[model samples]
Target: MIGDEVQVAFTKYDGSPHWHIGTRLLGEDEHGTWLHSPAGTFTWRPGLAFTYDRANVLCVPRGQHWAATLYDGGGASAVTTYVDITTPAVWSAGRVTMSDLDLDVVQRVGEEPFVDDEDEFELHRVRYAYPPELQAQARAASAAVLAAVTARQAPFDGATAARWLALAEPAWTPVAPPARPAG
Candidate 1:
């Protein structure tokens, strides 16, 4: 049974057009008809393609720049298992890679703002603003993490990757959910 939804946003190479890539979800309605989110209510139609198959352009694979997060009717978080549509319009045999993604912690924890003369500050409860440099570092770190997983065909180590990425990009924030209600 489909449990959750994965949303990915992708833009063209030249920064022109963009579209969303969404995962298919299976749910039972109050009336017992199987309803598919993003596709509206529908029953078995033998020859008709499934929602996911019809929205094949959205899935991106390794090497593609994309923002992705998963929702469990709750909120967004890092994703692990995802349908890979990473290959360009040439490949025919599509596959899903179950590599773990380790979210970077520094990005998770964010950055600390320090006063010019202040040497020490409170440890845990401190609230600070992330500088622009930090945010860039974080993005670079994220790219590195993606590269590694692609090379090793493994999941990212969340804490380390997050920390490294956070070092560069202080503006590490998780993807925000769309304002529209989930279907």
Candidate 2:
């Protein structure tokens, strides 16, 4: 139906990011589209007087005040295009610098040492950044592990949820246990 809600993954085309604005179609006159951030719902008309339609869509950060037309492809199938009001976007890496923080001088079990510069605090650094899909997959695995641990009545609870979650991802696994010498 025109009012159905769906999760559309944001796509980057030519560098700019866009969101599909929509609202639930109420009647023959009503149409739905989504917002870039998707804060809530909005409605439009069928006469093209407004900028929404069953076939219409809005481009993110580019297309200005113009209507959208969603070309239906027979039962939940359609190709959508919109007027380009803004220039194509360019992808640039965010300025993230890692400063190595030397935690070697720590003398306590739970004490965090200080670094001279704010940007120099890099006690932890990621090996590599994972894609969105991979991050989601990791989260799913972690959730499954927590569920299993809970089911087994492990001596843990919400207080230790973070620790348990961290354990979900195995950093390393031993191939075999060390053999014990016979007496």
Candidate 3:
């Protein structure tokens, strides 16, 4: 995983339709890996979605107990950044895959810490027919990520991400604008 460019993706527990295509790989350490995504990504749900560009991901490669920091480049989206607390990820030399827990801790430059996606979570609760125990776990995961992000916890503190960003600069590739989905 470290020192290799890997395909990074996030999916629902059952590998349903929802996903997050990543910024590509730069490198990693004990804390986690840094994904340099110059091109913003499209986040979708059934139909509606938005793209967030100029972002990077600092991800812990743990499955079912993983977390990530999404540092936005602040292009068009109002969200400056977010922390996705999730199930641990499957990180390998070939790819990185994480499961979404339906909760996000979002941050803006001058705004209070915000929790986004409870509605989405509830929607998925019925849609995915999530078990009670699993739903509870997802909620707990959300709380953990929020606490870490709000407290500026290690690795989540931005220092590791910053260092990785500086390292990734020389290796960055300019991606063409992503193709828009057909109407």
Q: Which candidate is the best by TM-score?
A: 3
Taking all chains together, each candidate's TM-score versus the true structure is 0.22, 0.17, 0.75
The candidate 2 region of ten consecutive residues with least summed lDDT is: 95-104
Q: Output the lDDT of residue 127, model 1.
A: 35
Number of backbone-clashing residue pairs for each candidate, in the order shown: 20, 18, 10
Q: RMSDs, each prediction?
A: 20.0, 25.5, 3.7
Give the distance in Å from residue 59's predicted Cα in candidate 2 to where it truly belongs: 47
Model 1 regions more than 4 Å off:
1-18, 25-131, 156-183
What is candidate 3's local distance difference test score? 0.63
Per-residue lDDT tens digits for candidate 2, residues 1-183, read 333333222222222222322322211212223322111223322221122222222222221212222222222322222222111222123111111121111111223221122222121113323345533433343344334333432111222222222222232211111122233
Between prediction 2 and prediction 3, the one with superior TM-score is 3
For each candidate, what is the lDDT? 0.27, 0.24, 0.63
Candidate 3 to truth, TM:
0.75
Candidate 3 lDDT over 2-109, as tens digits, reads: 334455556676775455454556765776656665544544544555565566665655454556655644566565456665667786655667767678888776
lDDT (Cα, tens digit) per residue for candidate 1, span 62-84: 33322222112211322322222
